[model samples]
Target chain A: MPITITKSTGQKELLNIEKVKHACRRAGASAQLCEVVGQEVKQQAKDGMTTKEIYEIVQGIISKEHPPVAARLNLKDAIIKLGPLGYDFEKYIARVLAAYGYNTELPPILQGACTTHEVDVLAVKDGRAAMIECKLRHEIGIFISIKDTMSTWARFLDLVDGSAIGKCPHIEECWIVTNSRFSHDSIQYGHCKNMVMLSWNHPKERPLPAWIDDKGLYPITLLPQLEHNTEKSLIDGGFVLLHDLATADPSLVAQKSNIPEETARDCVKKAQLILQA
Target chain B: MPITITKSTGQKELLNIEKVKHACRRAGASAQLCEVVGQEVKQQAKDGMTTKEIYEIVQGIISKEHPPVAARLNLKDAIIKLGPLGYDFEKYIARVLAAYGYNTELPPILQGACTTHEVDVLAVKDGRAAMIECKLRHEIGIFISIKDTMSTWARFLDLVDGSAIGKCPHIEECWIVTNSRFSHDSIQYGHCKNMVMLSWNHPKERPLPAWIDDKGLYPITLLPQLEHNTEKSLIDGGFVLLHDLATADPSLVAQKSNIPEETARDCVKKAQLILQA
Candidate 1:
């Protein structure tokens, strides 16, 4: 008999070893390591066990053998720890988009046709501009709803009208970016409106996790040696991406973040190790 | 020098005795009483006082003499006390619309063209149908924004498309009803979209307070003798409107609410007293 495991959404499904392997592979584990993790998870699988428990089991195994892979697997939770407020997440997104070759601006208050909007991230590349609305949810299992997408579309429409009347610059595309998942209705509405929707795992071709991994653009919060105060200082000092700290002088980072030079150096070293992996 | 008072929106304006008199008159006070209250408020007024403090002063003076009018004056706070959740507010709105000669239904999950929508109130009258969205705010000084209005418009559009394709009932009008005020941008977008906006003091001529006063459809939460548990029970028992409880038999009210008959009778009498005023 197959063991039924509960998902984050509270739906029950038979535990699939292949899914466990896939998650391991997605976290940059070796094929052999993936197989080992999969077999271990299958051995420990029990009826009515939660997927969160399965994740913890896998994390415990990977952290001992391959700390870099374990850090990659902790990406989603790390993103969540970035907020109770979304300001840091927005800054992180801007840095990620900057790495993607887009000249990004943080929170420009642009006048639309009817009113003004404080856009989260304005990315312009090669004569194409995109208005990105970043929604960061701290808790797990909360999906961005259709109302959020609809309002984004409405604001985009207003900006388009403003462009025609010369009130604001022309924005060719509107995007909804979130650190969480999008609800089914939100995806449906987004596609129907032709608005680019990016979340943790939507638009399966290249989701947010894939985007982060593709550029090795992990957040500074992903550093295991990072303390809460240091993390806040680093983020407040505009070192949102791990790469930002990894490349900066330790003394400069210390000066900007109000942290000890030794602590800044340690964070940068940990960030470099993960990026190198 | 004129005393400057701060509005709920945090904008400072010179104190106007005429506005105080208007508020008292609107609360169903006699003209002579309005003048008396206005004069008292003016005498006690000081620079930098908030509108809420002014309201409290007026409420205190009125409660001492005309308790019924004082109950009416307490309408906004009473409506806020109905929430922490909006379930009772939706029911209350249905009753209010019903009193206005519209056949109303509570929260029908209608299938729109793109997705399903759990509409707050669906009201039909004179062969015209309307979709009412109730936005309740428990806190003061928070205004309903354009994002809210835009999303409401988007959902209405989807329903209209559904109606055209024979998926949902035809909705000719979309209304946003809030217990608080609408932001300037919200009002602008609402008017631009031709959406009906009913807020605390919007539309200039008739607003939510006027609507409730016109039909004497105060909520059961307005009963002073009503305890928290009894209020919950009464609301759970489907007696949202004060008139519903006032007209119900004391025995029935007690049985439904799990309260003593005497308490129920006292609540009904108090409700009746306010309604009579």
Candidate 2:
């Protein structure tokens, strides 16, 4: 008889991204890890570390137990702290494609014109490099102008044409993305190239999926920020200037320009020694 | 039928613009005017002027013709003495449009944006304004990067939208222009209900057609340098160097991690005694 295989009947445990999100709490914390990632520890990547090694790099980036010195730094620095492991995410994405048994090379990003006009991640496998344009469109589209849409779309076309990059093969696809629907021309440009487009409008939405080898092209997913507003973020970051926001609005200050409304009240409450003859 | 009306035998006597050009020659000259229209004064428009007036303004502009000095100061000193004609060219374009019979306003220019963007002119007519954006495109487009296209297209959109005009009325049209062909998307944005997209790329193209109007709608055609590229108009009005062009280009010099190019060049060219040592 063939070797029998058994399937576990117990409740399947799910690996939720939320569980790892605690990592965000340590975002600004600094000890040694943040420093390593910030510098992009180049030597580590050459060692052939796996993707798990990369997360470990970011995990090692900020020691929660330490002070928040690293918080002021950007994402690149966090990667550097991982030593060689910091470069994991990119390699992981490449590896996912590699698992499909296709040859792939993640080339160094050239400063000017190589793939998509403002491509976020460029992956080369076939003769044509499919430009992967990434966007975390913070500002909404209803707020942008049509002219902006046109110019941006034109740039996308230029990206597909490879006018700027001398010899990076070509961007067979031109993708445009947004946190929400942009004006018309943006979508039209992509249609002309028959490329994929992605836009995210709310939290709890699954963003684009990753590109797979042989089966399908890149996945489209939406990312949404939860329980996060500008004010809350600032407060959590400990960047407070005043406790009361109403006082900050000038119309509350008796039409005066210089004095803060609440502060003016406080000054009135304080005793002043003024005697007139 | 009286003496046969002999149409004056075509002696190729002279076009009115040519006659005005000759009279302007008697008046004086401007380098920047020549830079745009060409060598002869006759090249300037002549449909509405008294001929003498255009000649006088042209004379006022040419530094070498120094009115009181009788052309003795040479071109150098006159260059220094002149100032940019604050007579807005866009407004002039509008006037020329009106002079020929087009009803239009040049649009109001937003003040305080010149540090990065500039509005050369603004004219209004027919309850609408044409937001004309102009520039000479000779710069090289090197590498295309996320930020590069982002910024370039962003600027292009900004120009077309007339976002620079802080208090401009909601008019019927906006025109973004250049001395080059526009991409398809640019044409699309120009399709807005109240916008127009135009360009002048032909070898002998005269942008802003001279005969678009019959009775003329705006009428300030006497200014020769207003045609385009008038450095003397720049001089006639007065201007200070924003940044030295030669020093801005890095390929001209290889040295790095040193003092600014402008300062270095100043020292090298002006300080001769130290060089002898």
Candidate 3:
């Protein structure tokens, strides 16, 4: 059935529902799943809206579908998008790399009982595969014991052994990424072949220019560079934290740079949530 | 009458009740208040505590004793020794002045809620007064807004008008310190007779040297001298927050520095509390 749809501006669109339904059945999802999503899309889709935003709306609806094969598919996509630990470490790694000018394709991280085990990030510059292992700085540099450091080393060893991702040929160079600095002994333990460690602590060699002003770019490497005198003068003159930018202090930053005052007030709501949690 | 007491390790000493009573009276506190603190400090305070720590213990007990008067005395002392906002702003200005080989006691900053006027700093060295106004930044080669740039000027105007910190009798040159490049407007605004605007944003003009390996030299002017390319870089590399170092992290750092953690923490805490307020 071909249907006419109207947008908020009074523009009209026509979509073929029968064609999509048949396509959905052929693709193995229930026809009802396609109908609900298709119906909503026809009703709400605006003229010239970006495909990515439309996809996001569909994704949101998928997460809310009843009897939920759509929800299962949403979970499947989420598992692929953000593997485990409530966030996709692989995606974050891809972001950090992208922010660094690397071409990368990343797979969902392999999940374990406690945390994600093997993160699958692929750096494809000029179509050559560069496999990376992703790690997050769950804790910001508060070291309780040496045991935690040793465990991270062991996880890398397991990735090297090819246990995290299922057996596959066409493997490339393995990169281990972390948000925190490696404890002194952990770096010593990472002396294996085909292993490169990138961390906020002891930033190893990376290919990013100092001109790019983002703080997280070459996170750890920049620290040692900053220990360099020239860089210090440049940064010290005009640095402001994102949080500080959002403050009510009129003299600290431009008014627009300050997020809406309500957003900061929302932090109080988050604090309340923590209290409730 | 003297009372005999045994230390935790069984060392014996005679305590003078009169001295204890007098110390409590000097602290404007009672014996019961002292006992309550003694119990908590036993759990919180460790061995080889300093006289300042003991004073803080007494002060904490007597905190309710004329809070405003206690606050005023501290404020007056900050004006005299530390300048406005403390953290050795006077020392930073002294270095800046001496760089051009000038001698100067800057005017005292008026400290109280009852006054709208505040001065950036009062520098006292070699028998002359250099009233200095300073600002800090984390970005390189950026312009600040006119509205945001007025606090330092407002404070300076307050001092010049003789409404802030009484009359500035030991008058010398007015110095403006900035961590970033001053806008064209800021330079014009700073162009009053006897005013010198110094931007730390320029490398040669940077009063601080690059790569100071000396831990003893870290100060306000010298801070931008260290080789940190970004704020997070310095923070993550264990650049301790003055407040965190003094109050919460002192016990942790005491393991490294020979100073008693409590006293170190308190000093850092007192300085930060004043800055934030």
Fnat of each prediction? 0.64, 0.13, 0.00
How accurate locally is residue B58 in candidate 2, as Cα lDDT from 0 to 100?
48
Better of 2 and 3 by TM-score: 2
Per-prediction DockQ: 0.60, 0.05, 0.01
Predicted candidate 1 versus true structure: per-residue lDDT over B1-277, tens digit per residue: 7899898778898988898888788778899998889889988988899989998889888898789888888788889988889888888898998998999998559988888998999999999999999999986579998888889988998899999999999999999999988989899888877889998888889988889987788998888756778888888877889899879998998898888898888888888888877
- How does model 3 fare in lDDT? 0.41
Which portions of model 3 show Cα errors greater than 4 Å? A1-277, B1-108, B111-116, B124-128, B141-145, B148-151, B163-170, B192-194, B202-277
Better of 2 and 3 by DockQ: 2
Candidate No. with top DockQ: 1
CAPRI rating of model 1: medium
lDDT of 3 by residue, B1-277 (tens): 3334443324455543344344453333446765555555454443454434444554564555434222322321222222223334444444445444455334455532222333556665566666675554443234543323333443344344553445544445566665445666555545533356666332344422221111112231112112223222323333333333334465554444444555445544543443332
lDDT of 3 by residue, A1-277 (tens): 4445443334455555464454333323556777787777767666565433455566566546532233222221222222224234455456556655778665555432222343467676655455565555444343212233333433333333454455332444555565445555445434323346666434444411111123322111121112223222212322112122223343332223333444334432322322221
Model 2 C-alpha lDDT versus the unseen true structure: 0.34
* DockQ of candidate 1 against the true complex: 0.60
Interface RMSD of each: 1.1, 12.7, 25.2
Clashing pairs in 1: none
Q: Name the weakest run of 10 consecutive residues (lDDT summed) in model 3 chain B.
A: B209-218
